[model samples]
Target: MSWRIGDYLDQSDLDVIVVGIDCNEGLKRLDEYGPWKSNEMSDVFSAERQSIGGEGKEYVEFIVHELKSMIDEMYRTLPGETSMAGSSMGGLISTYAACVHPHAFKRVASISSAYWFNQKEIEELIKESDLSNIERFYMDIGTKENTESMTILHT
Candidate 1:
């Protein structure tokens, strides 16, 4: 997934360290396993649960523990200053990370999230999760996107 975070850095003088990780690796196909999916999904679009490899949780742990440790060794970083953002399936996983790892992902932007993969589960997760740690949360849907998914998101 491509994010325009660089645009923000260019437009503003805010110092940012944007680390991009490749979620599509390990010889697995994109449909087979991806960081964006945290649960099994059997929809008409595809029959694979991208979370079969546990990329979502694994990625969160990697970012919060391993990657953060490495970054801290080099630079002084504040607690709860990390942010995550993505689009489509990537957006889904970003949202998951923010909810599941609030202490790490303080800011989140999920654009056109594919919540339909497990709409009920994600909605329940959002409802059950404590978002007090989040300093900012942003979500958006285009007018030309899936109507049914948009309706569900609205609900």
Candidate 2:
């Protein structure tokens, strides 16, 4: 659910392995982790925004915890080296995961995140929390990002 993730990583010339996670249940996963469901930014993307993602933060956290532990055990990974990246709602959750579990994810990239889904709450969350262990963050959005959107992309 991204643009040339592998090719981009290869071009960067960084010796980092890419792990692509598919979001077949994209909206559901977003609601589980995104802590938002206003459906206010329905026009931001072309996908049918039938219903907003549900409030399922606990479920999302549990799943992420389990996945990280399993991946660590199953692979020869270095500590403080995990990263998560995605686009749209995928981007939103990557940011959330890093904020909530910084030790597990040292770097995060949120590409064109659908912050308009629940902008106020996320803004409050950012102000209210203290993030640690995160070494890098990358975020991007289009110049023409939904002029009608309340959470218009600034950059």
- In the order shown, the candidates' Cα RMSDs to the true structure are 5.1, 5.0
Any residue pairs clashing in model 1, and if so which? none
> How high is the CA lDDT of each candidate model?
0.69, 0.68
Question: Which candidate wins on TM-score?
Answer: 2
Error of 1 at 104 (Å): 1.2
Worst 10 residues of 1 by lDDT: 37-46
Candidate 1 wrongly placed segments (more than 4 Å): 25-54, 146-155
lDDT of 1 by residue, 1-155 (tens): 44576777889978777777766643243342244443343232235433533456676677778988898678776655888887776677788888888888889989888767556767888899999999999999988886664454455
The local distance difference test score of model 2 is 0.68
Can you give the TM-score per candidate against the true fold? 0.72, 0.72
| Best-matching candidate per lDDT | 1
* Candidate 2 TM-score over all chains jointly: 0.72
